[model samples]
Target: MKNIRNFCIIAHIDHGKSTLADRLLEFTKTVQVTGGQMLDNMDLEKERGITIKSHAIQMEHEYKGEKYVLNLIDTPGHVDFSYEVSRSIAACEGALLIVDATQGVQAQTISNLYMAIDHDLEIIPIVNKCDMDSAMPEEVEDEIIDLLGCERSEIIRASGKTGLGVEEILSAVIERVPHPVGDEEAPLQALIFDSVYNTFRGVIAYFKIVNGVLRSGDEVKFFNTGKEYEADEIGVLKMDLSPRKELRTGDVGYIISGIKTSKEVKVGDTITHIDRPCSKAISGFEEVKPMVFAGVYPIDASDFEDLRSSLEKLQLNDASLTFQPESSLALGFGFRCGFLGLLHMEIIQERLDREFDMDVITTVPNVSYRIYDKQGGMTEVHNPGGMPEPTLIERIEEPFISASIITDTSFIGPIMTLCLGKRGELEKQNYISGNRVEIQFKMPLGEIVIDFYDKLKSISKGYASFDYHQDSYRPSKLVKLDILLNGESVDALSTLTHVDNAYDMGRRMCEKLKELIPRQQFDIAIQAAIGAKIIARETIKAVRKDVTAKCYGGDISRKRKLLEKQKKGKKRMKQIGNVEVPQKAFLAVLKLD
Candidate 1:
């Protein structure tokens, strides 16, 4: 245990966490590096140039003729994947806080740092991207010192691309980070940090042994589910799973028990021997709080059960995802899914399509609200359709977030303008260093759920980094805006909005739907309404045929007769015509800029 070092890498997005990880792997000769971002194995991750999952691998390094075992977990840097970072942090004793030389310390950097500090993990500050011409190593080093209160000599200046200071980082890990401490004689207690599903191998759970030893074929039980199974195989994580006879205390490894159901193995649950179980489960695991809610329905209604199974398997891989059965009048039966953010929601949708071959329609995303009635009965509503009638409601409270944005001084004005437009209140601003500012704001989570991140990125030319956490809920003047098609309300199209911008937003949504909804044989009336009042309306004209053209050169009365006949046909069609809303129309509500 003294020679074992378990640590993870945490940083802001695109700040060289994966690149530095690759350098570390190469330096330790863990794997043959043929390309960059070797740990980001997902194709979507490669396409987006972002890490979506936390990857763990074991490596061996020889220092001064003494062999050492290093367990390195590379975590995603995006704010949406902060839960992944938290899980990785929990399983490690230390973290490498990587900061980009050009970008300095951004919002996510500060947030992730705070999480590490909260976990009491030893932080080793490292400045990456030192080879770039625009790199500001000195300024970034000073910023790191201010953020972490670490000495200049302790901070390592390195370039992930050039492989500089890789050896020093390894040496620091061996010298600075404390070895994992636990008792091998105690009852077996392993904390399962992550797991994955397999068709041939059943479920594979990756865990860190906190106490005692886990051997192959041992009878193990999950603490949360209280389900027991024999360990089919036990191994340590390398580029691949390397079989081990036994994993003792302070060892991170994987165990397969031929567990067919995903529910049997829960992330953050404790694993213990059936004969001599641990007295208590491991604590300090925080539950995931979803920031956005949307309905995910199958494109074909009959595929509902398949969608449910697909989501179940997907949830096993992404424990942060939460869902329950829900039905929509407009979209039929589906699940109301909770996601960390818009990007996380999009990625899940894409994954469902690519991985499970499940074609799904995702409704407009919204945040959950607390609805209080006149009788003082309170209900939590995640979907607009689930909201009670206006007459029965007394007040509605929406979730708010404390958002922190780090950007250049030049872009502060536009960033503030954007936030203020979203009904955000400026809390305070501080100068992180010369010309770099950190702006704080208190904004409704609903305001930033859709396009705020994209807008911030575009306005700042990708120079700004943003991070946020949920704050207390506040009572607000909110109204439910319903979209109607020919006097019929579509439950899926309804949304809760602040009264101040409801009218304008309703108008924009009606116009946007007018462009997205395909033209029917009869006119389609798209109206945005608040209760009995129609606040905005747009008409999608019918696809009319030239009925009068057949009577060309006819008398005016004859043309009028033919037009009158067509008009009667259209009126009949309108009465029975069901508007088939294209899938794009449902998604268009998100882009109402």
Candidate 2:
């Protein structure tokens, strides 16, 4: 049997997971052999400094006369992609738990480590970014030993950015990480951990061989569903940067089983021999669900088709992205999309802009809300634009989330006050990694799912980290504050707010909406209303009269033309009876900025 080592790199966001993968790719001679360039091939990946999706690559390296095929998976760091990270961990026998040398252990690091431990994978702790001026290897090593209970000397210090300790880290993988120990001659069983598309060859299903040899042209069945297909091509990932034929048991390879689309190959599905099919599939595969929702609309209506095509291609690569067509009275046509979290949202948006080159209008993000009615009917609404009438909602509750914030002790007070201000209920407080403190709070899921991360970073000067999960549905006296331009509801100005803050929030919304819309041909009334009550009001002054009653010397036809122009301009005014609305009124209500 070939010596195989499967491992993943885990770290908090911006902690250098991709950089480490690049170094490993270089050291194993995979880049030289395959002629693959640096890892950040996608413009978005390089620009963002984060890995939005989990990616795996293979390398063949000889250590101490032992030839080992190292399968390394680089995982996403944000909490939104935690499910993906967990799956990557499960696909491996060990993981390099990367902790930033200068920043020490962040909350995401701890969360990902726990996930790795839960998967029963061996942990090879690695301290990265040792080249940073603030890096304190001794303190960081001590913290890792104390917090994670790992041997002090076992933590390998490396600068992934500088290619330091790359060879040593690979050697340690051979010594510390266990080789795959499953039988190769038993019923052919393989676990499909990831899948992608090859433009000319169709879907390339990546799987780890568990039992029995799988050669090209063999018939295989997905054990979970008993679906069968003949292998069109079977291959290992070559340094040439693509799949090469003839993969066998115990090796990580791709199966081009005439699976034309990636949709047929799911992560965690078991590929087995048709004649001697395995009796069981791999355990511990969880379906990833999205937690954030937003409305995505094209800047131009003609690009709607382009948007759909782009989304489809993106979904082919990322299974977690979800979307559905939605239209609003304000936004003519758009989509209500669900994502794993904020990072996922940003990634998708960035892809749309960068890859597709499509300009889009995005709505303020909202979490899934639970609607309770007196008639015993219940429903979940992910977009505010989809909310039912107030009369239909006898009682409404929004999802609450449990959030953990890690920061230095000095910022605790400011952070606490901000949380309290946002209606977060304190759960507990504790110290982690010595001087760093973690504060747990129960917050309205909607509050933290939006710009909370950016605001937290701004408040903490980029020193704080936050992560959250849905807790439960809690009763909330909430109202949809709608702003009216003229007499019609300006759909873009609507916001879901607690009843207590309706007046103040409405005023702020109306003021902002007024600023966004341009001065109209006529004066207009911009008012925020809660049922029959007007909570706040603003005005858009009307354009001055264009034509005056005057006698023309010898230009009677010119005067008539001027009068016709004035009439047309008056009709262009957004008016509700005596009120005239400006062009800016509509735009102002739609965007908070």
RMSD of each: 2.4, 4.3
Query: What stretches of model 1 exceed 4 Å from their correct place?
Result: 400-420, 424-443, 455-473, 552-554
Show the lowest summed lDDT stretch of 10 residues, model 1: 546-555
Error of 1 at 179 (Å): 1.4
Tell me the whole-model lDDT of each prediction, alpha carbons only. 0.91, 0.77
Model 1: what TM-score? Answer: 0.93
Q: Which ten residues in a row have the lowest lDDT in candidate 2?
A: 579-588
- Estimated TM-score per prediction? 0.93, 0.86
Report the Cα lDDT for candidate 1. 0.91
Cα lDDT tens digits, model 1, 471-585, are: 9899999999999999999888889999998999999999998999889989899999999999999999989899877786856999999889999999999998898777788
- What's the lDDT for candidate 2? 0.77
